[model samples]
Target chain A: MKHSLSSLLLAAVLPVALVACAPSEAGTTTDGGLSGKLTLTGSSTIAPLALEIAKRFEERHPDVRIDVQTGGSSRGISDARSGLADIGMASRRLKDGEIELTAHAIAQDGVCMILHASNVVASLTDDQVRAIYLGEIENWSEVGGEDAPITVVNKAAGRATLEVFTKHFGLDEKEIQADVIVGDNEQGIKTVAGNPDSIGYVSIGTAEYSAGSDVAIKLLPANGITASTASVGSGSFPIGRPLNLVTFGEVSKLQRAYIDFCRSAEVHDLVTGLYFVPVRTAQ
Target chain B: MKVKSTDRILVWSLRAASATAGSLVLLILCFLVLESVEGITRVGAGRFLNDPGWHPSQGAESEFSLVPMIAATIASTIGAILLAGPVGVLAAVFCRFYAPPKLARAFRSIVELLAGIPSVVYGFWGLVTLVPLVRELAPPGASLLAGILVLAMMIVPTVALLAFAALKNVPPGHLEGATALGLSRWTTIVKVVFPSAASGLGVAIVLGTMRAIGETMAVLMVCGNITKVPSSLFDPVRTLTANIALELGYATQEHRAVLFVSGLALMIMIVLLVFVQERLQRRARLA
Candidate 1:
C-alpha cells in the first residue's frame, strides 16, 4: 500500500520539477519588435499613474506587457540605476549624487497641510506650520483654532512624503514630534478627519480628492500658495515636486517607446483624473 | 518482502521531510548571520546593543542602536502577558470547572473562532475602536498602553485555549482527592489542580508571550511608532518587528543589514524565552 503511495508522490513531483526548469516563453522579446516585457517599480504615487498609462499602452501594443510596481521613490531610483527595473517611478525630484540615472518629469504634485473641515483656522503661515510640526506649537489655540490639543499626524520613516515635508519645513525628520504615524495619504487624511484638532500633510492630489468627496478633510495654503493643480502647474507652489520616471544612461528603443507613451498627450486626462498636474501643463 | 520495502521507503521519506524542516531553520539562521555581518562590523556589536539612538536617515553618521526597540518589544510583551495571562487562565478555569458541558463547548468554539480571525482584522478593530477610546482618556491615543491592549486582545484566545487544555489534562482523581480532604472548591483548584497542571500552564504562558512578541501589525497600528524608550504607559514606542516592517521596503545596504541584526536579536530573545520556560517547567515538575 505504502509503495503505491510513494510511487504516486514521485510521479507527481518529477513532472513539476521538469516544468519548473523549463524556460519561460514570455521572456523573449525581439530587439526592435516593441513586444518585450517591461517592469516598472517604485513610488506608490507613480504606480497607479503608470498602471493607467500601461493599460492604455498595452491596448495599443497588444504584444507588449508592462508590469507596474510600487515600493516608494527610493526603491524606484535604486532599482532603475541598478538595472533591476526598466523604469523606476519617483514622486519627488531626484537628489544630487543620483547621476547614474536620468529623470523624466511625467507629472507634478505638491505636499500640503490638511486639516479637519471643522477647523476654524483656514490658513497658517509657513512659520506656524513649521513650528506645529516641530512640536513647538502644541495646541490649536496657538494657530487660531479651538482650545483643543493639536494632534500632529506625520508619515512613517523612508516615505517620500515625510522626506519632502521635512525638507520644506527646514526640520530634520527626527525633530518632528508626531502624535500618530501614518503610512500613506489615505491614512493621513483619515487621521486628520477623525480628530478635530489634528493636522497632517499629504499629496495635494489625494487631499483634494478626499476633500471633494466630503471626507471632512480640507487642504491648507502653504506659504501663501494654495495646494491645487493650477498652483502646481503655474509654479506658484514652493512645495511642488515633479513625478519622475528614471532610467539609467541610454534606454532601449522599447524603453523610450514606453516613456514617450507616458509623456504623450493622451495620458493628460488620466493624469488629471488622479488630480496631478500634467508635465506639459507645467512647462 | 514488498511490504518491508514499502515500509522502509515510507520511513525514509518521513525522515527526509523532518530533516528538510530542520535544515530550513539552519538556512535561515545562516542567511541572517551573513546579512548582519556588515551592520555588526559597521557599528560594532557592542554599540548596536548598548546605544539607544537609532538615526539611520543621517547619511554617514547614522546610529543603529537596537536598545529602544528591544526595550519597547519586551515592555509591550510583558504588559500584554500581564493583562492577558490572568484573564485567560481564569476564563479557562471557568470553562473547565463551573460552566455546564454544552456551554463550555460553545465557549470553547467562540474562543477557537477568535483564534482563527486574522491579525489584520484585529488591528483594524483596534485602530477603529480601542484607539479612539484611548485618545479620549489620554492626549495621544497611540501609546504603549494601546499596543498592550491590542496585543492582549490578540493573544487571549490562544492563551485561553491552551490553558483550558492544560487544566483539562489534570487527572480527575487529583481533584477528587483534594475535595475529599475537605478543601473548598476555590482552594482545591488553586492548590491541587493548578500545581498538577503547572508545567502545562507554563507552556500556555510561553506560547502567549511568543505570540505577543511576534505580533507586528496590530501593535504597529496602535503603538505610536516613536523610536524612543517609553517613559510612561501613555508614551508611544516602536517594536523591532514594526521597525523592520516600516522601513525594509526602502532600506539600503547598511540600513538593511542593521534590520537583519534586529531580526537576529529577536530570534535570540525568543530562544532565551523558550529556554527559561523549559527550565521553569522542569523545576515545577520536580517540586
Candidate 2:
C-alpha cells in the first residue's frame, strides 16, 4: 500500500519536474539577429530616457537588445569605472577621480525646481531651496507661497537628483528628509503638480513638461539665473549638470557608433524635443 | 520481487537527484563569494562598517556605509515583530479554540495567498498608496512610521500563517487530554496545548522576523530611503536591502565590497536567530 502511494506521488510530481526543467525560450532579444544582449545600468534619473532611446534605436537596429537600469549617479559613475555598465547616465558631475577614469562628456542639463500652478511662489534663491530640503524652510509662507505647510518631495536615495541636492545643500545623510520621497522623475513631477503647497526638483525635461501643463508649474530661478534652455546654453543656471555616457570599454565598435549617433547634430532636435539642453556645437 | 527491486532503484535515484539539485545552492554561494572577494579586499573592514556617509559619488576616498541601512533593517524587523506578534498569536489562539474547520481552512488559504504575492507587486502598491498615506498621516510625510507600517502589513500574514500551522500541529491527543481534565477551552489552549507547542511558535515568530528583516520591495517604496538614524516613526528611513538593491547596479570595487559586507551582516543575523532557536529547543527538550 505504501509503495503504491509512493508511486502515485512520483507520477504527480514528474510532470511538474519536467515542466520546470524545460529551458526558457525567452533569451533576451527577439526578431532579426541581435548578437549579444547589452545591459546598461546607472542613474534612475536617466533610465527612462535611456530606455526610450533604446526602444527607438532597437526599432532601427533590431538585432541589438538593450536593458537599461537605474541605481543613481554614484552607481553610474562607479559602474563605468569598474566595467559593470555598458553605458552610465548621470545628471550629476563626476568627481575628479571619476573624471580621471573617463575623458569625454556626452551631454548637459539643468536641474529645475518646480511648484504647482496654484502655487504663488514664483522664485527662490539657492539658499532658500537648500534650506527647504534640509527641513529648515517648513512653510510655504516663508517662500512667498500660501500659508499652507510646504510639502518637500524628493527623489529616491542614490538617484542623481538626490546626489546633486545633497551635495549642493551640504546636508548630512541624517539631516535629509522629505515630506515624501518620490522614486522617479515622472512621479516627482506629478506629486508636486497635484499639490499646491509642494516643492520638488527634476530634470530640465520633466520641468519643461510640467511647465507646459495646463495646471503647469514653473521652475524657480536659482541664484540670479533662470533655469531656461537659453540660460543653460549660456551657462548661467546654477543647477547645471553634464550628462555622460560611460561604458566599460574604450571606443568599442558598437559603443562608438552609439555615442557618435547621440552626439551628432541630427539628434540635437530630439534632445531639445525632450527638454534637455542640446550638446554645444563645435565652434 | 523484480518489480520491487526496480522500484527501490527508482527511489534511490530520486533521492540522489534531489541531493544533486540542492548542491546547486552551494555552487551559487561559491560563485558569489568569488565575485565578492576582490571588492571586499579593496574596502577595508573599518570603513565598510563605520562610515555613515554613503558617498560613493565623492570617489574612492568615500565608500558606501551600510550602517544606516543596517539600522533600517533592524528597525523594520523589530517593528514587524512588535506589530505582528500579538496579532498573529491571537489569530492562532482564536483559530485553535473558536474557529470552525471550514472558516479556519479559508482563512489559512487567504493568508497563504498573501504570502505568495510577489515582492515587486507589494513594492509598487506601497509606493503608490502607502507612501502617500503615511505622508498624509505624519507631520510632513515621509516617516519611518510609513516603512514600519508597510513592513508590518507585509509580514503579518506570514507570521500568522506559521503560527496557525504550528498551533494546529499540537497533537489532538493533548487537546483531548486537557478537556478530559475539565479545563476550559482557553485554559486548555494556554496551559496544555500552548506549552507543548511553544517551541514551534518561537520558531514561527523567528521565521516571521526573517521575512521582515529581508523584505526589500515594500519597505523600499515607503521608507523614503533616508540613510540616517530615525528620530521618530514619522521620519524617512533607509534599510539594508533597499540600499543594496538601490545601489548594487552602480557600486564598484570597494563600494560593492561594502554591500557584500552588508549582506554578511544579514547572513549573520539569520544565523544567530537560528542558533538561538536551536538553543531554546534544546533547553525545552532537556526540561
Candidate 3:
C-alpha cells in the first residue's frame, strides 16, 4: 500500500516539476520581439479603454499579458507608487503630492451631470448644482423643473469622479446630502435612468453611449460648456479630466511599449468607439 | 486487538480535528483584534458609538462613526427575520404535516434549491425587479424596505430547511399522546409539537438571522447605501458590511484599519447572537 501511494504521489508531482523546469517562453523575444506581463490598476473610467488597447496590443504580440483592475484613481496612484501595478489608470490629472509618479495621457473623458430624459430640467448653473447637492434646493421646481423632490445620486468615496465633481462645484464631500450612492459610471447612469427625479454625474463617454442606446438618460451641460467628446477634445469642457496611465521611477521595455501603444494613433479608433477623445486629437 | 487499535487512532484524529477547528476561531478573533487596534484608537472607541456620520476621507472632517451603520444592520436583520421567520416556519409545518410525502419531498427540494442560488443573483434580481416595484409605491426605490424584502427572500430557505428538520425531530410519542387525549390535529401541533420543538425552532431563527446579518451583496445593491439614520421605511441606509466593501478596495492606513474594526464589530455581534441563542435554548430546556 505504501509503495502504491508513493508511486501515485510521484506521478502527480512529475508533470508539475517538468513544467516548472521547462524554459520560459514568455520573455524570449521570438514572437514580434515584445513579451511579458503587465498589470494596470485604477479608475473604472479608463478600464474599458485600457482593456481594449491591451487586447489589440496582445494580438500584435501574443506573449504579452496585461491584467486590468478597477478600484478608483486613488488606488491607481497608491498602487503605482507601491509597485503593485506596472501601470495605473487615473482619470484626473495628478495632484501635487503625486508628482513622484510619471503620467502618460492616453485619452480625455469629461464628467457630466446626467438626468432621466423625462426630466424637464435642461441645464443647471454651478451654484444651482451646488445648492441641490448641499440639500438647500430640495425640489426640482426650485431649479426650473417639476414639483417633485430631487434625488441626488453621489459617487462613493475614493472614486475619481466624486473628487472631480466635488472640487469643480466647490462643495465639501461631507456636506452633500445624497439619496443614493453608486460605485461605477454605469451604475450611476442606470440609477438616474431608472428614476425620473434623480440626478447623477458620470463619465461623458458612458452617459452619451447609454443615452444613444436609448437608456432614457440625458447629459446636462456643465457651466455652459457642452458635455460631449467634441467639447472635451476642443478643451472647452470645464469638468474634463485626463485619462492617464501613471508609472513610478523607471519603466521596463514591455511597459514602455504598452504605454506608447496606448497613446499612439493606432488605438484612436478604439478610444473614439468608447466615446472618449484621443489624447493626440485633444492636444 | 487490531480493530481496537484502529478505533483508538480514529478517535484521536477526530479529537485533533475538532481542536483545530475550535482554535482557528480564536486565532481569527485575535487577528481581528490586533488589526483593528490602530483604527479604534485613532478614531477613539467612543466615537464609534456616538459620531454623527461616516466621512473617512475628508481630512479633519473625517468622522468614523459606526452608529448609523450598526443601526442599519440591526434594523435590516430584524426586519428580514420578522418577515421570513413565520413564513418559513409555517411552510415547514405544512410540508411536515399537511402535504403528501412525495409532494413534501418536492417542496423541500425547491426550498433547498432556493438556498443554492447565489446571493449576487438575488441582489441583481432585487435591483432590477423589486427596486422598480418599490418605486411605484415610493419614490427613490432603493430603500431599507427594499433591502429587508431582498434579505427576507434570500434567507427564507435557510429558515425553512432548519425549521423542517426541527419539526421532524418532535418525538412521535407526544403526538400520539395528544391524539389520544382527543385534541384536534392543529391543537396538537400547536400545543405538543411546537412546545417540544421550541428550542430547535429558536436555533432555526438564530441561524437565519446569522445569514441575514452576514449578507452584504444583495442588501448593498438594494439598500441605497446612504449613511444615515433612517427615519422611515422608505429612507435609505448603509450597513456596516456595505461600508467596508465599498471602501476597502482603495483604503490605506487608518481607512483600511477602520474596515477591520467593522469586521470585528460584525464578529462580536454574531458572537453575542450565538450566546443569546444558547441562553434561550438552555432556558427552554429548564422550563
Candidate 4:
C-alpha cells in the first residue's frame, strides 16, 4: 500500500518535473522562414477589432498564431515596453513621454457624450458638457430636459475612454462627480439607457451602432460636431483619438506583417464592424 | 502484510492531503501580506481602511480609501442576511414539519438546483429582469436595493439547505419528549428543536454572511459601481469585492498593490468573523 502511494506521488511529480525541464521557447526561426507566435495585449476597446483582424491574419498565415489579450491601454504600453507582448493595442494616441516606443495608427475613434433617446437635449457646448460632468448642471431641465435630477455615469479610472474624456474636457478626474461609475462603453450605454435622467459618454462608433439597433441611446454632439465616422474623418470632432499599435524599439518581421495587415484596407470592414472608424481610405 | 501496508499508506496520504490544504491557506495569507506591505506602507493602514475615497491611477496621485466600499459591503451583506435569513429558516422549518412529503421533496430539489446555478446567471437575470423592474419602481434601477434583492435570492438556498440539515439533525427523542408533555406541535418545534440546533443555525447564518460578502459578479452586475457613501438603499455604491474585480485586470504596480491590500483586508474580515463565531459557540457550549 505504501509502495502504491509513493508510486502515485511519483507519477504526479514526474509529469510536473518533465514539464519544467521542457524547452520554453515559443518561436523558432529557421532559414528565413516566418513562422512563430505573435502576442497582442491591451485596450479592451481595441481587443475585439484585434481579434477579428487576428482571425483573418491567422487564415492568411497558417503557420503563425496571434494571441490577443485585453486589459486596458495602459497594460498594452507596459507589456510592450516590458517585452511581454509583441504589440500593444492602445485606443488612445501615445503621450509625449511614451517616446521609447513607435506607434502605428491602426484606427481612429471618437469619444462622444451619450444620453437616453428620450432626452430632448440634442447638442451640448464644450463648457456645458464640462459643467454636467463637474456636477454643476445637476438637473435635466437645466440642459433642456425634464425636471428630474441628472445622474452622471462616468467611466472607472485608468480606462483610455475616461482618460481621453478628461483630457478633452480639461476636467480633473477627481473633480468629476460620478453618480454611477461604469467599466466599459457597453456598460455606459446600458446604464444610460436604463436610467432616463442619466447622461454619460462612450465610444461614438459603439453608441451609434447600438443606437442603430435596439439600444435606446443616442450620441449627443460635442461642441456642434456630431460624433460620426464622417465627422472623425473630416477632423471636425474634438473628442477623437487615434487607436494605435505600439511596438518597443525595432519591430520583428512577423510584428511588422501583422501591423501592416491591421492598417491595410483589407481590414476596413472589420474595423468598422467593431464601431471604430477605419483609418485606411480607398485610393 | 500487504493489506496492513496499504491501510497505513491510505492513512498517511489522507493526512498529507489535509496538511497540504492547511499549508496552502497559510501560504496564501503570507503571500497576500508580503505583496501588500509596500502598498500599506505607501498609504498608511488606517487611511486605507478609514478613508472615504479610492483613486489608484498611473502617473497620478492615488488615494486608497476603503471607507465607502466597506460601508457598501457591510450594508449589502446585512441587508441580504436580514432579508434571506428568516425566510430561509422558516422555509426549512416548514419543509421539515408542516409540508407534505412530496411537496418537501420538490422544494428541496428546487433549492439544490438553485444552489447549483452559477452566480453569473443570477447576475444576468438581475441585470435583465430585476434592473428593469427596479427602474419602474425606482429611478436609476441599478442601486443598492437591487443588489440586496439579488444577493438575498442568491443566498436563500445556501441558508435554507444548511438550516434544513440542522433542523433534521435535531434528536427525534427531543421532539418525542415535547409531544409526551402535551405541548402544541408549533410550540415544541419553537421551544425544543430550535434551541438544540442553535449551533447549526448559527453556522448557517455565518456561511450565508460569507457568501453574501464574498459575492462579486451578481453584486457587481446589480450594484451601481459608484464611489460614494450610500445614504439610502436606493443609492448606488461599490463594494470592496467589486472594486477589486473591476480594477484587477488592468492594474499596474501601485494600483495592483492597493487591490491586494483590499484582498488582504477581506481575508482578515472573514477570519475574524470565523474566530468570533467559534468563541460564541464555545461560550454557548459552556453555558
Q: Which has the greatest lDDT?
A: 3
Clashing pairs in 2: A34-A63, A75-B250, B135-B141, B143-B234, B143-B235, B144-B235, B145-B233
lDDT of 4 by residue, A219-272 (tens): 887777778877987788989999999999977888888898999999989987
**Stretches of model 1 off by over 4 angstroms after superposition:** A1-7, A10-30, A230-235, A281-283, B1-9, B50-52, B277-287
| Candidate number of the best DockQ | 1
Give the per-residue Cα lDDT of candidate 1 at A252.
Answer: 84
Predicted complex 2: DockQ: 0.25
Q: Is candidate 2 or candidate 4 better by lDDT?
A: 4
* Tens-digit per-residue lDDT, B1-287, candidate 2: 96787687667657755765787667656655665565567766677667766665444457567677777788878987898877888887777678898997887788889888887777667655665666566544445776777677777787788778778777888989888899998888888877887877787788788888888867766676767677678777778887777666656556667667677677778779879778756754553
lDDT (Cα, 0-100) at A96 in candidate 4: 88
Task: Give DockQ: model 3.
Answer: 0.31
DockQ of each: 0.44, 0.25, 0.31, 0.43
Positional deviation of residue B266's Cα in model 2 after best superposition, in angstroms: 0.7
lDDT of 2 at B276: 77
Give the clashing residue pairs of candidate 3, or none: none
lDDT of 4 by residue, B1-287 (tens): 98777767666666766676798799899999998998888777887766547787845567778888888999999999999999899999999999999999999999999988999899878877887788777667778999999999989999999999989988899999999999998999889988988887887888888999999988888788987879998888899899988888878878888889989889988998898678756754653
- Report the Cα lDDT for residue B74, model 4: 93
CAPRI-style quality class for the chain A–B interface of candidate 2? acceptable
Residue range B1-287, candidate 1, lDDT tens digits: 98877777777666666676798789899998888888899768897866648877667767777888999999999999999999999999999999999999999999999998998888878776777788898767778998999899888999999999889888889988888899998998999989888888888889899999899988877787888888999887899999888778777767888999999989888888889788867865674
Q: What tens-digit string does per-residue lDDT give for candidate 3 at A51-70?
A: 99999999998888888998
RMSD in order of candidates: 3.0, 6.0, 4.7, 3.3
